[model samples]
Target chain A: MSVDPPVVHGHINGQVFSAAADATLLQVIRAAGLQVPTLCHLDGLTPVGACRLCLVAIEGHPKLEPACVTTVAEGMVVHTHTPELETYRRMAVELFFAEGNHVCAFCVANGSCELQDVAVEVGMDHSRFPYQYPQRHVDASHTQFSLDHHRCILCTRCVRVCDEIEGAHVWDVGYRGSACSIIAGLDQPWGEVAACTSCGKCVDVCPTGALFRKEDGTAEKHPHPERAAQLAEARHEHRWTNP
Target chain B: MATKPEPPAPHGLGDSLVERLHAVQQQHGYLPPEELQRLARAMARPLSEVMGVASFYHLFRLVPPGLHRCVVCRGTACFVRGSERLEASLRQRGVAFETASCVGACGQAPVLVLDGAVRSGDPGELPWL
Candidate 1:
């Protein structure tokens, strides 16, 4: 018999609740039906806390912490929504929009983009920061997938998923700060990468239209966010024994 | 005959990814993609992680520099003290120089480091200026 994980008591937005000790604050808040926005977080993948959208104010703490990575503990108080958090979240979303050439009208993930949905939910009508409009290139070298740097948010989700889950480290980031970009296999063009397995896992986890299948048309895309979780569950259950 | 102490081993996979890249840059003057790939294999790390670290730090150079690398400090103190003037003078001389966010020497305002030598003071005072 497997023992259950210990329960940790915590106050989220002033509501007391007990959650599995191993669960992150985001998971607890989500279980309690409180919506906390996230961009770089996906189930079944290690959290890098790259996106600052899920920052929550913990009582008695001077600095805000990301909900997705912070583990829950006893007597902890977390505020998921506040005016300050809303302002910061709005700016984070705006910066994402300003940093990249995210033209939603022409993007392949237009109606289904998590970034667009978050922007609308956060009430980002316009960007306060000036648009960078940096020149970026697109790579359609992969036989099945294409990468568009113009829409990438530098979240490292695809990078992490490809490395941790897919076991293929073909993708890497090149450059620093505002000029940083995702490169495949030593900054080579994607078509020439020999390590790529063409699994399409990166495309499924991409929050934006940055990675997409070659056959997908404009706004004709649907990413499977649960695929990774399902795969993890099957692996843990040893479902392959049926064969 | 006196024997010199053996030099430290070239930074390899056993060291932090950053140190390995630094060692590579120190040897090659800049990071080459082929060498990075070899380092990735030696270190058993993903190329993406290696590349990420390589690109994140300003100190790492991926491309070869010109014959001389002139770094001008652009910190607040230097900017206030007329670092721009020194940069302008260098530009007029038809010499290439790069602007650094800061040289960590605010007291020495308007500082310029040419070929790894630091110089400070009014733009016109320096012999080259």
Candidate 2:
């Protein structure tokens, strides 16, 4: 008595496949076993397409499109890996390092960082741009967490997850241009924020060592990015039954 | 029968972030951390996100301005007209100044805005130094 949803077909790197029209191209390509390097993207949060790492060449489109936000269409052809795209991705990753104080040696998320893994995946051996050693401050005022502006990539994953998923809206950016930074509760010390529930969700969603547990040392930080996806799914699935 | 009313926006966090920042900038000349955080709480957004928006525009100043602002134009025309010398002189005199890409006054090459007035010609004309 119900009609089947329309099936959309697309080609990723010349492999033909059919997918549900509602799913994003990223979802389909991921289902097809293709991996696209990303830093700002989390599974459950609304894809902000901020990092520009998941950009892929779509046929007939002059500019590259973000796979996470770009939906699949009939007869669509998406190329995830190409010389130009690889170069761009490498440059983007390198710029992220050059623009920030991403000292991997002393970072808490050194081993468990997506930025580190992506740099390795993209073959970014050394940065070409001059290092911008801007003097940034670290906020260790929180009882349970610490925020290091130096290690932050400005990916806004913590900001997004905190605002969109946790609904705390506790984090926001202050200033403009290259001097921009993350602030907690009206730029007050994290320990002073009355709004913070000590949820630790922001720390978990951060892609780098910028946000981490106070108890962690260098390379001791462990972030579970999948927790957001799991929580989103559980909330949706249990909403009706919980009542 | 009447239609249902739409839900109110969450935390006043809508598309007015830039406008709100401008309002704050107008009120204080620059966006300080405490004010930015206050706006974030009132708008129901994160302080980091608010800071991000505030810092994107060159017109927005996060730090306090000097008593007098000397903006040296770095446009192509002004570059050829020795705006560099003018800027250097200001620096030598320890006069606090900043540089802008273009001041939209290309006709007045080697132009510099002292205090608030845009003046053109030789750097020697600046007697304040």
Q: Write the per-residue lDDT of candidate 2 for residues A37-97, one digit (tens) a residue.
A: 9988898787767899999998898889888787788888889999999999999999999
Q: For every model in order, what is the number of clashing pairs?
A: 1, 21
lDDT (C-alpha, whole model) for all candidates = 0.84, 0.83
- Model 2 interface CAPRI class: acceptable
lDDT of 1 by residue, A1-243 (tens): 989989889799988889987778889899998998999998877776789899999888888888888888778888989999999999999999999999988788989899999999999999999999999999998888999999999888788677767878788777877788988887777878888898888899899999998888889878876676666666676553232
Q: Score the docking of each candidate (DockQ).
A: 0.30, 0.34
Which portions of model 1 miss their true places by more than 4 Å? A1-3, A239-243, B1-14, B75-77, B92-94, B100-109, B119-129
lDDT tens readout by residue for model 2, B85-104? 88888788887778889898
- How far off is residue A196 in model 1, in Å? 1.0
Compute the lDDT of residue A137 as modeled in candidate 1. Answer: 95
Task: Output DockQ, candidate 1.
Answer: 0.30
lDDT of 1 at B57: 83
